[model samples]
Target: HPKFDMVMHDLLVLLKPKFVVMDATFAMEGNGPNRGIVIPMNLILASSDLIAMDKLCCEIMGIDWTDINYLNFVDQHYQREEAEPQIIGEKIEDVTQKFLLPYDDLAVRAQRWVYKNYFLTRLCFGTPFLNMLQGCLNVYRKVDEEIMGKEWVNKYWDNSLPR
Candidate 1:
Protein backbone atom coordinates (compact mmCIF):
# COMPACT_ATOMS: atom_id res chain seq x y z
CA HIS A 1 0.00 0.00 0.00
CA PRO A 2 3.00 2.29 -0.43
CA LYS A 3 1.50 3.98 -3.46
CA PHE A 4 -1.75 4.62 -1.60
CA ASP A 5 0.20 5.96 1.37
CA MET A 6 2.27 8.18 -0.91
CA VAL A 7 -0.83 9.56 -2.63
CA MET A 8 -2.48 10.33 0.71
CA HIS A 9 0.67 12.03 2.07
CA ASP A 10 0.97 14.17 -1.05
CA LEU A 11 -2.65 15.29 -0.78
CA LEU A 12 -2.37 16.17 2.90
CA VAL A 13 0.90 18.05 2.32
CA LEU A 14 -0.43 19.98 -0.65
CA LEU A 15 -4.02 20.87 0.34
CA LYS A 16 -3.60 21.21 4.13
CA PRO A 17 -7.27 21.83 4.85
CA LYS A 18 -7.81 23.00 8.44
CA PHE A 19 -10.98 21.06 8.97
CA VAL A 20 -12.81 18.13 7.40
CA VAL A 21 -16.59 17.81 7.28
CA MET A 22 -18.33 14.52 6.59
CA ASP A 23 -22.00 13.94 5.85
CA ALA A 24 -22.96 10.71 7.52
CA THR A 25 -26.60 11.09 6.50
CA PHE A 26 -25.97 8.04 4.35
CA ALA A 27 -22.95 5.79 4.15
CA MET A 28 -22.14 2.93 1.80
CA GLU A 29 -21.76 -0.59 3.15
CA GLY A 30 -20.71 -3.99 1.77
CA ASN A 31 -17.75 -4.01 -0.64
CA GLY A 32 -17.27 -0.25 -0.40
CA PRO A 33 -16.05 2.99 -0.01
CA ASN A 34 -17.29 2.18 -3.53
CA ARG A 35 -19.70 -0.39 -4.94
CA GLY A 36 -22.11 -1.07 -2.07
CA ILE A 37 -25.62 -0.50 -0.84
CA VAL A 38 -26.27 2.87 0.80
CA ILE A 39 -27.39 2.83 4.43
CA PRO A 40 -29.18 5.95 5.58
CA MET A 41 -28.27 7.32 8.99
CA ASN A 42 -28.99 10.94 9.82
CA LEU A 43 -25.69 12.27 11.19
CA ILE A 44 -23.04 14.84 10.39
CA LEU A 45 -19.40 14.89 11.51
CA ALA A 46 -16.71 17.58 11.45
CA SER A 47 -13.27 17.93 12.93
CA SER A 48 -10.13 19.99 12.40
CA ASP A 49 -7.81 17.08 13.07
CA LEU A 50 -7.41 14.70 10.12
CA ILE A 51 -6.35 11.65 12.12
CA ALA A 52 -8.97 12.41 14.71
CA MET A 53 -11.59 12.78 12.01
CA ASP A 54 -10.65 9.50 10.30
CA LYS A 55 -10.50 7.68 13.61
CA LEU A 56 -13.94 8.92 14.52
CA CYS A 57 -15.30 8.01 11.09
CA CYS A 58 -13.93 4.51 11.51
CA GLU A 59 -15.45 4.36 14.96
CA ILE A 60 -18.80 5.38 13.53
CA MET A 61 -18.40 2.79 10.80
CA GLY A 62 -17.62 0.15 13.44
CA ILE A 63 -14.30 -0.68 11.81
CA ASP A 64 -10.85 -0.76 13.34
CA TRP A 65 -8.92 2.36 12.26
CA THR A 66 -5.59 0.53 12.54
CA ASP A 67 -6.81 -2.06 9.99
CA ILE A 68 -6.65 0.71 7.38
CA ASN A 69 -3.03 1.21 6.29
CA TYR A 70 -3.56 4.85 5.31
CA LEU A 71 -4.68 5.65 8.85
CA ASN A 72 -1.43 4.14 10.10
CA PHE A 73 0.41 6.33 7.61
CA VAL A 74 -1.36 9.39 9.03
CA ASP A 75 -0.44 8.39 12.55
CA GLN A 76 3.23 8.04 11.63
CA HIS A 77 3.53 11.16 9.45
CA TYR A 78 1.73 13.37 12.00
CA GLN A 79 3.40 11.66 15.00
CA ARG A 80 0.03 11.44 16.68
CA GLU A 81 -0.77 8.79 19.24
CA GLU A 82 -4.09 6.99 19.25
CA ALA A 83 -6.47 8.60 21.70
CA GLU A 84 -10.09 9.55 22.03
CA PRO A 85 -10.52 12.22 19.36
CA GLN A 86 -12.16 15.35 20.78
CA ILE A 87 -15.73 14.79 19.63
CA ILE A 88 -17.56 18.12 19.38
CA GLY A 89 -21.21 17.07 19.08
CA GLU A 90 -22.91 13.78 19.97
CA LYS A 91 -20.92 10.88 21.39
CA ILE A 92 -19.88 8.24 18.81
CA GLU A 93 -21.71 5.43 20.62
CA ASP A 94 -25.02 7.16 19.93
CA VAL A 95 -24.42 7.07 16.16
CA THR A 96 -22.37 3.91 15.65
CA GLN A 97 -23.72 1.08 13.48
CA LYS A 98 -22.22 -2.16 12.24
CA PHE A 99 -21.89 -2.35 8.48
CA LEU A 100 -21.76 -5.55 6.44
CA LEU A 101 -18.36 -6.27 4.93
CA PRO A 102 -17.79 -7.32 1.31
CA TYR A 103 -19.11 -10.62 0.02
CA ASP A 104 -16.38 -13.21 0.57
CA ASP A 105 -17.15 -15.54 -2.31
CA LEU A 106 -14.09 -16.81 -4.21
CA ALA A 107 -15.40 -15.49 -7.50
CA VAL A 108 -15.79 -12.02 -5.98
CA ARG A 109 -12.27 -12.13 -4.54
CA ALA A 110 -10.76 -13.30 -7.84
CA GLN A 111 -12.69 -10.69 -9.80
CA ARG A 112 -11.43 -7.95 -7.47
CA TRP A 113 -7.87 -9.23 -7.66
CA VAL A 114 -7.92 -9.32 -11.44
CA TYR A 115 -9.30 -5.78 -11.54
CA LYS A 116 -6.56 -4.43 -9.27
CA ASN A 117 -3.77 -6.09 -11.28
CA TYR A 118 -3.29 -3.85 -14.31
CA PHE A 119 -1.19 -6.31 -16.30
CA LEU A 120 -3.70 -9.13 -15.96
CA THR A 121 -6.62 -6.84 -16.72
CA ARG A 122 -4.96 -5.47 -19.82
CA LEU A 123 -3.97 -8.93 -21.01
CA CYS A 124 -7.50 -10.18 -20.64
CA PHE A 125 -9.45 -7.18 -21.88
CA GLY A 126 -7.16 -4.97 -23.98
CA THR A 127 -7.50 -6.90 -27.25
CA PRO A 128 -9.90 -5.35 -29.75
CA PHE A 129 -12.43 -8.19 -29.65
CA LEU A 130 -11.83 -9.07 -25.99
CA ASN A 131 -12.90 -5.61 -24.87
CA MET A 132 -16.46 -6.65 -25.63
CA LEU A 133 -16.20 -9.78 -23.51
CA GLN A 134 -18.00 -8.36 -20.50
CA GLY A 135 -21.01 -7.36 -22.61
CA CYS A 136 -20.95 -10.73 -24.34
CA LEU A 137 -20.87 -12.55 -21.03
CA ASN A 138 -24.00 -10.74 -19.89
CA VAL A 139 -25.76 -11.66 -23.16
CA TYR A 140 -24.68 -15.29 -22.92
CA ARG A 141 -25.82 -15.61 -19.33
CA LYS A 142 -29.25 -14.24 -20.23
CA VAL A 143 -29.61 -16.52 -23.27
CA ASP A 144 -28.49 -19.58 -21.33
CA GLU A 145 -30.95 -18.80 -18.55
CA GLU A 146 -33.83 -18.49 -21.04
CA ILE A 147 -32.91 -21.69 -22.89
CA MET A 148 -32.79 -23.59 -19.58
CA GLY A 149 -36.22 -22.19 -18.60
CA LYS A 150 -34.91 -20.32 -15.58
CA GLU A 151 -37.90 -18.29 -14.43
CA TRP A 152 -36.16 -16.03 -11.89
CA VAL A 153 -35.14 -13.44 -14.50
CA ASN A 154 -38.76 -12.99 -15.63
CA LYS A 155 -39.91 -12.93 -12.03
CA TYR A 156 -37.35 -10.25 -11.16
CA TRP A 157 -38.10 -8.19 -14.25
CA ASP A 158 -41.85 -8.39 -13.67
CA ASN A 159 -41.50 -7.33 -10.07
CA SER A 160 -39.06 -4.50 -10.90
CA LEU A 161 -40.98 -3.02 -13.84
CA PRO A 162 -43.16 0.08 -13.48
CA ARG A 163 -46.33 -0.98 -11.80
Candidate 2:
Protein backbone atom coordinates (compact mmCIF):
# COMPACT_ATOMS: atom_id res chain seq x y z
CA HIS A 1 0.00 0.00 0.00
CA PRO A 2 2.96 2.30 0.62
CA LYS A 3 3.88 1.97 -3.02
CA PHE A 4 0.32 1.97 -4.32
CA ASP A 5 0.45 5.64 -5.26
CA MET A 6 3.67 5.05 -7.18
CA VAL A 7 2.17 1.97 -8.80
CA MET A 8 -0.90 3.97 -9.77
CA HIS A 9 1.28 6.80 -11.02
CA ASP A 10 3.16 4.42 -13.30
CA LEU A 11 -0.01 2.73 -14.51
CA LEU A 12 -1.64 6.05 -15.37
CA VAL A 13 1.50 7.17 -17.13
CA LEU A 14 1.44 4.12 -19.36
CA LEU A 15 -2.24 3.42 -20.01
CA LYS A 16 -3.50 7.01 -19.89
CA PRO A 17 -7.09 5.96 -19.53
CA LYS A 18 -9.56 8.05 -21.50
CA PHE A 19 -12.01 8.11 -18.63
CA VAL A 20 -12.56 6.90 -15.08
CA VAL A 21 -15.95 6.26 -13.49
CA MET A 22 -16.52 5.86 -9.77
CA ASP A 23 -19.56 4.41 -8.06
CA ALA A 24 -19.97 6.26 -4.79
CA THR A 25 -23.36 4.77 -4.06
CA PHE A 26 -21.99 2.60 -1.30
CA ALA A 27 -18.42 2.95 -0.18
CA MET A 28 -16.15 1.44 2.44
CA GLU A 29 -14.57 3.33 5.31
CA GLY A 30 -12.39 2.31 8.26
CA ASN A 31 -10.16 -0.73 7.47
CA GLY A 32 -11.45 -0.85 3.87
CA PRO A 33 -12.65 -4.09 2.26
CA ASN A 34 -10.84 -6.43 4.64
CA ARG A 35 -12.73 -4.98 7.59
CA GLY A 36 -14.62 -1.76 7.06
CA ILE A 37 -17.94 -0.05 7.59
CA VAL A 38 -20.22 0.71 4.66
CA ILE A 39 -21.75 4.13 4.01
CA PRO A 40 -24.29 5.19 1.42
CA MET A 41 -23.05 7.91 -0.89
CA ASN A 42 -25.60 7.69 -3.73
CA LEU A 43 -23.69 9.33 -6.51
CA ILE A 44 -21.67 8.52 -9.61
CA LEU A 45 -18.85 10.69 -10.86
CA ALA A 46 -16.99 10.39 -14.14
CA SER A 47 -14.20 12.20 -15.90
CA SER A 48 -11.71 11.98 -18.69
CA ASP A 49 -9.05 13.26 -16.30
CA LEU A 50 -8.17 10.66 -13.69
CA ILE A 51 -6.26 13.02 -11.43
CA ALA A 52 -9.10 15.53 -11.25
CA MET A 53 -11.66 12.83 -10.64
CA ASP A 54 -9.55 11.26 -7.89
CA LYS A 55 -9.02 14.60 -6.17
CA LEU A 56 -12.73 15.39 -6.09
CA CYS A 57 -13.48 11.90 -4.78
CA CYS A 58 -10.83 12.29 -2.11
CA GLU A 59 -12.47 15.46 -0.88
CA ILE A 60 -15.88 13.85 -0.97
CA MET A 61 -14.44 11.26 1.37
CA GLY A 62 -13.20 14.11 3.60
CA ILE A 63 -9.53 13.32 3.00
CA ASP A 64 -6.92 15.94 2.22
CA TRP A 65 -5.32 15.13 -1.13
CA THR A 66 -2.10 16.84 -0.07
CA ASP A 67 -1.59 14.22 2.64
CA ILE A 68 -1.46 11.55 -0.06
CA ASN A 69 2.10 11.90 -1.40
CA TYR A 70 1.59 9.75 -4.49
CA LEU A 71 -1.36 11.83 -5.55
CA ASN A 72 0.90 14.87 -5.42
CA PHE A 73 3.47 12.97 -7.50
CA VAL A 74 0.86 12.00 -10.05
CA ASP A 75 -0.52 15.52 -10.09
CA GLN A 76 2.95 16.79 -10.86
CA HIS A 77 3.54 14.01 -13.36
CA TYR A 78 0.48 15.22 -15.29
CA GLN A 79 1.69 18.82 -14.92
CA ARG A 80 -1.46 19.81 -13.11
CA GLU A 81 0.42 22.50 -11.11
CA GLU A 82 -2.14 21.99 -8.32
CA ALA A 83 -5.01 23.48 -10.28
CA GLU A 84 -8.26 21.79 -9.21
CA PRO A 85 -10.86 20.88 -11.77
CA GLN A 86 -14.25 22.61 -11.80
CA ILE A 87 -16.85 20.19 -10.54
CA ILE A 88 -19.70 19.84 -13.02
CA GLY A 89 -22.64 18.83 -10.86
CA GLU A 90 -23.66 18.75 -7.20
CA LYS A 91 -21.68 20.86 -4.75
CA ILE A 92 -18.91 18.77 -3.14
CA GLU A 93 -19.84 20.05 0.32
CA ASP A 94 -23.40 18.71 0.00
CA VAL A 95 -22.13 15.19 -0.60
CA THR A 96 -18.99 15.12 1.49
CA GLN A 97 -18.66 12.43 4.17
CA LYS A 98 -15.78 11.90 6.51
CA PHE A 99 -14.31 8.46 5.82
CA LEU A 100 -12.37 6.32 8.23
CA LEU A 101 -9.25 5.29 6.38
CA PRO A 102 -7.63 1.92 6.78
CA TYR A 103 -5.18 1.16 9.58
CA ASP A 104 -3.92 -2.04 7.89
CA ASP A 105 -2.37 -3.24 11.14
CA LEU A 106 -1.39 -6.58 9.67
CA ALA A 107 0.40 -4.96 6.74
CA VAL A 108 2.14 -2.50 9.03
CA ARG A 109 3.32 -5.26 11.32
CA ALA A 110 4.46 -7.38 8.39
CA GLN A 111 6.41 -4.46 7.00
CA ARG A 112 8.13 -3.99 10.34
CA TRP A 113 9.08 -7.66 10.68
CA VAL A 114 12.81 -8.26 10.22
CA TYR A 115 12.25 -11.11 7.78
CA LYS A 116 10.18 -8.93 5.44
CA ASN A 117 13.09 -7.00 3.99
CA TYR A 118 13.05 -5.96 0.34
CA PHE A 119 15.14 -8.86 -0.88
CA LEU A 120 12.94 -11.37 0.92
CA THR A 121 9.79 -9.70 -0.40
CA ARG A 122 10.98 -9.97 -3.98
CA LEU A 123 12.27 -13.51 -3.36
CA CYS A 124 9.01 -14.59 -1.78
CA PHE A 125 7.01 -13.37 -4.76
CA GLY A 126 8.93 -15.64 -7.14
CA THR A 127 8.86 -18.69 -4.87
CA PRO A 128 6.23 -21.23 -3.78
CA PHE A 129 5.98 -19.25 -0.56
CA LEU A 130 3.93 -16.76 -2.52
CA ASN A 131 1.30 -19.44 -3.10
CA MET A 132 1.18 -20.26 0.59
CA LEU A 133 0.79 -16.59 1.44
CA GLN A 134 -1.96 -16.14 -1.11
CA GLY A 135 -3.75 -19.18 0.26
CA CYS A 136 -3.66 -17.68 3.71
CA LEU A 137 -4.93 -14.36 2.37
CA ASN A 138 -7.82 -16.08 0.62
CA VAL A 139 -8.85 -17.74 3.87
CA TYR A 140 -8.62 -14.46 5.73
CA ARG A 141 -10.68 -12.61 3.14
CA LYS A 142 -13.32 -15.33 3.11
CA VAL A 143 -13.64 -15.31 6.88
CA ASP A 144 -14.04 -11.54 6.88
CA GLU A 145 -16.61 -11.78 4.12
CA GLU A 146 -18.57 -14.35 6.07
CA ILE A 147 -18.36 -12.44 9.33
CA MET A 148 -18.95 -8.94 7.99
CA GLY A 149 -18.97 -8.28 4.22
CA LYS A 150 -22.23 -9.95 3.23
CA GLU A 151 -24.16 -8.29 6.02
CA TRP A 152 -22.80 -4.85 5.26
CA VAL A 153 -23.73 -5.18 1.60
CA ASN A 154 -27.24 -6.25 2.46
CA LYS A 155 -27.77 -3.44 4.91
CA TYR A 156 -26.05 -0.45 3.27
CA TRP A 157 -25.82 -1.17 -0.45
CA ASP A 158 -29.13 -0.04 -1.82
CA ASN A 159 -30.89 -1.51 -4.87
CA SER A 160 -31.13 2.00 -6.39
CA LEU A 161 -27.54 1.90 -7.55
CA PRO A 162 -26.49 0.20 -10.77
CA ARG A 163 -26.18 -3.55 -10.53
Candidate 3:
Protein backbone atom coordinates (compact mmCIF):
# COMPACT_ATOMS: atom_id res chain seq x y z
CA HIS A 1 0.00 0.00 0.00
CA PRO A 2 2.79 2.41 0.93
CA LYS A 3 5.08 1.71 -2.02
CA PHE A 4 2.20 1.51 -4.55
CA ASP A 5 2.55 5.21 -5.43
CA MET A 6 6.33 4.93 -5.78
CA VAL A 7 5.93 1.80 -7.91
CA MET A 8 3.52 3.56 -10.25
CA HIS A 9 5.79 6.61 -10.47
CA ASP A 10 8.79 4.36 -11.14
CA LEU A 11 6.90 2.51 -13.89
CA LEU A 12 6.05 5.78 -15.62
CA VAL A 13 9.65 6.94 -15.33
CA LEU A 14 10.84 3.59 -16.68
CA LEU A 15 8.77 3.98 -19.86
CA LYS A 16 10.51 7.32 -20.70
CA PRO A 17 7.82 8.68 -23.01
CA LYS A 18 8.98 11.31 -25.48
CA PHE A 19 6.01 13.63 -25.29
CA VAL A 20 2.47 14.09 -23.91
CA VAL A 21 -0.49 15.43 -25.87
CA MET A 22 -3.53 16.10 -23.70
CA ASP A 23 -7.03 16.72 -25.02
CA ALA A 24 -8.61 19.05 -22.49
CA THR A 25 -11.43 19.83 -24.89
CA PHE A 26 -14.61 18.60 -23.17
CA ALA A 27 -12.99 17.64 -19.88
CA MET A 28 -15.03 15.94 -17.18
CA GLU A 29 -15.34 16.74 -13.50
CA GLY A 30 -17.17 15.08 -10.60
CA ASN A 31 -17.67 11.26 -10.98
CA GLY A 32 -16.11 10.68 -14.40
CA PRO A 33 -15.80 8.29 -17.37
CA ASN A 34 -19.28 8.86 -18.94
CA ARG A 35 -20.99 9.92 -15.69
CA GLY A 36 -19.87 13.42 -14.73
CA ILE A 37 -20.29 17.10 -15.38
CA VAL A 38 -18.46 18.02 -18.57
CA ILE A 39 -16.42 21.20 -18.84
CA PRO A 40 -15.94 22.50 -22.35
CA MET A 41 -12.27 23.42 -22.01
CA ASN A 42 -11.44 23.90 -25.69
CA LEU A 43 -7.70 23.53 -25.49
CA ILE A 44 -5.10 20.98 -26.58
CA LEU A 45 -1.98 20.79 -24.39
CA ALA A 46 1.36 19.31 -25.35
CA SER A 47 4.74 19.08 -23.65
CA SER A 48 8.01 17.19 -23.86
CA ASP A 49 8.00 16.88 -20.05
CA LEU A 50 5.13 14.86 -18.61
CA ILE A 51 5.45 16.07 -15.02
CA ALA A 52 5.71 19.70 -16.07
CA MET A 53 2.74 19.23 -18.38
CA ASP A 54 0.75 17.65 -15.59
CA LYS A 55 1.60 20.52 -13.24
CA LEU A 56 0.58 23.05 -15.88
CA CYS A 57 -2.64 21.14 -16.62
CA CYS A 58 -3.47 21.06 -12.92
CA GLU A 59 -2.95 24.82 -12.78
CA ILE A 60 -5.23 25.26 -15.78
CA MET A 61 -7.81 22.99 -14.11
CA GLY A 62 -7.67 25.25 -11.01
CA ILE A 63 -6.43 22.46 -8.73
CA ASP A 64 -3.22 21.94 -6.77
CA TRP A 65 -0.88 19.50 -8.55
CA THR A 66 0.79 18.57 -5.27
CA ASP A 67 -2.42 16.83 -4.20
CA ILE A 68 -2.09 14.30 -7.02
CA ASN A 69 -0.36 11.07 -5.95
CA TYR A 70 1.99 10.40 -8.86
CA LEU A 71 2.99 14.05 -9.03
CA ASN A 72 3.51 14.13 -5.29
CA PHE A 73 5.50 10.90 -5.45
CA VAL A 74 7.79 12.38 -8.10
CA ASP A 75 8.17 15.59 -6.14
CA GLN A 76 9.08 13.62 -3.04
CA HIS A 77 11.52 11.31 -4.82
CA TYR A 78 13.14 13.73 -7.29
CA GLN A 79 14.91 17.03 -6.74
CA ARG A 80 12.91 20.23 -7.20
CA GLU A 81 15.62 21.82 -9.37
CA GLU A 82 13.58 21.40 -12.59
CA ALA A 83 12.35 24.68 -14.06
CA GLU A 84 8.63 25.23 -14.85
CA PRO A 85 7.41 24.97 -18.44
CA GLN A 86 6.82 27.97 -20.70
CA ILE A 87 3.22 28.63 -21.89
CA ILE A 88 2.82 29.29 -25.61
CA GLY A 89 -0.93 29.91 -25.77
CA GLU A 90 -3.58 31.03 -23.29
CA LYS A 91 -2.46 32.06 -19.85
CA ILE A 92 -3.49 29.77 -16.98
CA GLU A 93 -5.33 32.64 -15.27
CA ASP A 94 -7.45 33.26 -18.39
CA VAL A 95 -8.29 29.57 -18.87
CA THR A 96 -8.45 28.30 -15.30
CA GLN A 97 -11.72 26.49 -14.56
CA LYS A 98 -12.33 25.01 -11.14
CA PHE A 99 -13.80 21.55 -11.49
CA LEU A 100 -15.85 19.75 -8.86
CA LEU A 101 -13.82 16.85 -7.53
CA PRO A 102 -15.10 13.27 -7.61
CA TYR A 103 -15.57 10.63 -4.86
CA ASP A 104 -16.45 13.30 -2.28
CA ASP A 105 -20.12 12.37 -1.98
CA LEU A 106 -21.44 10.02 0.71
CA ALA A 107 -22.26 7.22 -1.72
CA VAL A 108 -18.73 7.19 -3.18
CA ARG A 109 -17.19 7.41 0.26
CA ALA A 110 -19.27 4.42 1.43
CA GLN A 111 -18.41 2.44 -1.68
CA ARG A 112 -14.70 3.18 -1.18
CA TRP A 113 -14.91 2.14 2.46
CA VAL A 114 -16.64 -1.13 1.57
CA TYR A 115 -14.10 -1.97 -1.14
CA LYS A 116 -11.17 -1.08 1.12
CA ASN A 117 -12.39 -2.86 4.25
CA TYR A 118 -11.07 -6.45 4.44
CA PHE A 119 -14.20 -8.09 5.82
CA LEU A 120 -16.51 -6.15 3.53
CA THR A 121 -14.27 -6.94 0.53
CA ARG A 122 -14.31 -10.67 1.37
CA LEU A 123 -18.09 -10.67 1.84
CA CYS A 124 -19.01 -8.33 -1.00
CA PHE A 125 -16.41 -9.13 -3.66
CA GLY A 126 -16.03 -12.91 -3.25
CA THR A 127 -19.31 -13.77 -4.91
CA PRO A 128 -20.79 -14.48 -8.33
CA PHE A 129 -23.60 -12.04 -7.49
CA LEU A 130 -21.00 -9.26 -7.42
CA ASN A 131 -20.86 -9.52 -11.24
CA MET A 132 -24.23 -7.78 -11.31
CA LEU A 133 -22.49 -4.63 -10.08
CA GLN A 134 -20.50 -4.54 -13.32
CA GLY A 135 -23.69 -5.11 -15.31
CA CYS A 136 -25.44 -2.34 -13.40
CA LEU A 137 -22.50 0.02 -14.00
CA ASN A 138 -22.57 -0.88 -17.71
CA VAL A 139 -26.28 -0.09 -17.89
CA TYR A 140 -25.72 3.19 -16.08
CA ARG A 141 -22.90 4.04 -18.50
CA LYS A 142 -25.09 3.36 -21.53
CA VAL A 143 -27.91 5.46 -20.08
CA ASP A 144 -25.49 8.27 -19.23
CA GLU A 145 -23.93 8.08 -22.69
CA GLU A 146 -27.32 8.35 -24.34
CA ILE A 147 -28.36 11.25 -22.11
CA MET A 148 -25.12 13.27 -21.90
CA GLY A 149 -22.45 11.92 -24.25
CA LYS A 150 -24.87 11.92 -27.21
CA GLU A 151 -24.81 15.72 -27.40
CA TRP A 152 -20.99 15.79 -27.18
CA VAL A 153 -20.73 13.04 -29.79
CA ASN A 154 -23.01 14.98 -32.17
CA LYS A 155 -21.09 18.19 -31.54
CA TYR A 156 -17.76 16.41 -32.14
CA TRP A 157 -19.09 14.95 -35.44
CA ASP A 158 -20.10 18.44 -36.51
CA ASN A 159 -16.81 19.91 -35.16
CA SER A 160 -18.79 22.39 -33.07
CA LEU A 161 -17.46 23.14 -29.62
CA PRO A 162 -20.00 24.67 -27.29
CA ARG A 163 -19.21 28.25 -26.40
Task: Highest lDDT: give the candidate number.
Answer: 2
lDDT, candidates in the order shown:
0.76, 0.81, 0.79
Residue range 24-137, candidate 3, lDDT tens digits = 888899888757998899999998777888888888777899888878888777543476678898888899989887766787777678877777866667776568888899
Candidate 1 clashes between residue pairs 3 or more apart in a chain or in different chains: none
Of models 1 and 2, which has the larger TM-score? 2
* Candidate no. 1 TM-score: 0.63
Over 51-158, each residue of candidate 1 has an lDDT whose tens digit, in order, gives 788787888889998988888886778543445666677777988998776776786777668778888767766665565777899898888888764666565666
| Candidate 2, poorest ten consecutive residues by summed lDDT | 77-86
| Full-model lDDT, candidate 3 | 0.79
lDDT of 2 by residue, 52-125 (tens): 88778889999999887778888776543345576777998999999988784977677656255777766676
- Candidate 2: stretches off by over 4 Å: 80-84, 112-116, 133-163
